[model samples]
Target: MKPLLSICCTSYNHENYIKETLDGFLMQKTNFPIEILIHDDASTDRSAEIIKEYAQKDGRIITILQTENQYSKKIKPWPNFLFPMAKGKYLALCEGDDYWIDPLKLQKQVDFLETHSDFNICFNASKIYIQDTNTFKEDPFRGKFPEILTIKDLARKNYIRTNTVVMRNNFTLPEWFNQLPFGDWPMYLIMIKDNKVKYIDDVMGVYRIHSEGVWSGKDKAKMIEMTLIGLDMLIKSNILPAHINKILLKRYRKYAFKAQKEKFRGYLKNR
Candidate 1:
């Protein structure tokens, strides 16, 4: 049977959690065939060995082990380089560090997309687990949006979770997607601008927050810099006028600055 979905998982230094993540995929309660494309991005830890071990056991899992680390390269080669290799009509992504909490996640999303041909992508809400407390944070943006989201909605707030997003691979990813500050933000914006995105309104995945995590480790100043870059793109794309962009950018910039300063303070205290 042809696989109905292709899962693109990026793995790097996630040996401790890769097994759980793979287990989540294996537990999916779907009748349709599913295939996994696991990319081990030259992890220095035992993550590559773990992924290979699982692939050896599971026929549905396909593993890609890189000999060299790709993170130091100036250009980002994420789903962009991996998407073309996906064999399914729909792409369901689950990074090595993250795992699905609900086994029915794939089935539910697949059914929704298969039934609703008009919707290009669908995403559900997710639980944000902070490693410090090992507790899930309150996610206010966990609900369904209108059939189509505007650029303004995307600009005003980013509600989509990368772990929950299941998008149709019909359209070529926008060139700017790779350069955009946050990977998911650009991809969501591109889909919103070009196609109809639906919300599933369920928290079916857990996004682990740890010190080593890329998004979690980013300092406030760096985050603000990235946000500004995104703001500039939106303004240039004509999604927001100059005045609106300026006001919003200033508002977010302040928050970013505060965060940066606080992080610096923590560093100094530790030092």
Candidate 2:
């Protein structure tokens, strides 16, 4: 069956958590057909074997188990690989460390987008699972948000939860996207360039904040620095129009000031 949606996942040394992730994919209740794309980036762990086990059992699973690591060579798996190969009209993201709690997550998002032609994507609230604290808390921005969002609103910031995202599969990302330290922010920026996204007012998934998390585990200073770097790179790439660039530039300055304060706090602590 040609899938109407594709669940895109990337795994690396996630043997401990991959099974839960696979279960999350398996548990989705959708009216439309969906394909699962698991791109294992040559994990030295047993991640590949676990993926193989699942793929052998499910025909919907399409696994690409690489023998050599690509991320180490500055190659990202999604944009360069799994994304273009998606056979679905829409794509949903869920990292190997995260899982969906609401079985109707996909159905809800698809229903909204299928009815609304102007929107390119939709996402909902997700709980944050803090491993060190062993607590599941509401998303930081559980506060009210516009039912529809555009790049104009997002340019100032990106509070969108990646794991909750379900976006149109039509957009093409630049090759330079691989160079960005973070992919979701810029990728969504591109997706909503001339488009808008829907916000579903429901908690549907869990985003694990663990020490092993690729970015979530990073120190505050590093995460801020990466955000700044990605913004600057996007601005330099001139992908978005000049007006959008203006908004990004303002955001860039705000983060720069925050970065300076972080440095000062570090300096004070060392004294």
Candidate 3:
């Protein structure tokens, strides 16, 4: 039977947390079948072994265990590998280090998309767990998200957490997407370009923040640099309107000033 939803997960060296992540998927109670497509990007740790253990138990769990790390080869595993295998009406994203808190997450999001034909994407609020501090932070949109979002709203700031997103899976990924160092923001921007985005107020997932994570662990300057490069690529793509470009440019300037301030503070502290 063809699945109505596909849970696309990507991970590397997440042995400690992969079980929790897998359990989250197994606990979901949905009216329709959902396929779990996971790709372990040549983890040096026991992540692949853990994934294999779950795959052996459940027929719905599908996996790709790479001998060589795809990210090291500059390959975007989600688009090139996992997404191609997703045979479902909608795609839900969650990294191996993250876990869904609500079991009805798939049912709620799928119900929304099924009823609202005009909306192409449905995402909910997510809590961020900081491993270093051992603290939980509320999602930015916990109580303050608009009922509906547009491409322009996304351009201003990325409030849609990747783990909570369940989007229509019919569109082809842009060619430049492979070159991006990051994924969520670009994916959301492209997906919402012509379609409407819907936000669910419920907190459905947890985004784990650890030192081993990519964006969260990186230095502020490098994060800003990479984000600017991505925004520039989007602007040059010419898919977005000129007004959107202006909005992005304003954001770019804000990041630049913030980065500069951080640098100045560091210099003063050293002096």
lDDT tens per residue, model 2, 1-271:
7999999999998998899889989999998999999999999999999999999999999998899999888788888889978999999998888888889999999998898889998999888899888898888787756878888888876778878999888889888888899898888888786878888989988888889888988999998899899999999999898999999999899989999999999999999
Q: How does candidate 2 fare on TM-score?
A: 0.96
Considering every candidate listed, which one attains the maximal TM-score?
Answer: 2
Ranking by lDDT: 2, 3, 1
The CA-based lDDT of model 3 is what? Answer: 0.89
Task: Provide the RMSD of all predictions against the true structure, rounded to 1 decimal.
Answer: 3.9, 1.3, 1.6
* Per-residue C-alpha lDDT of model 1 across residues 177-264, encoded as one tens digit per residue: 5566667766655555444677776678888888788676676667667776766665566554465466567656776677677778
Which stretches in model 2 have alpha-carbon errors above 4 Å?
none
The global Cα lDDT (0 to 1) of model 1 is 0.75
C-alpha TM-scores of all predictions:
0.82, 0.96, 0.95
**For residues 56-135, what per-residue lDDT tens digits would candidate 3 score against the true structure?**
99999999999998887778888899899999999999999999989999999999999998888999888999988889
Instruction: State the lDDT at 259 in candidate 3.
Output: 76
Question: Which scores greater on TM-score, model 1 or model 3?
Answer: 3
Task: Kindly indicate the candidate among 2 and 3 with the higher lDDT.
Answer: 2
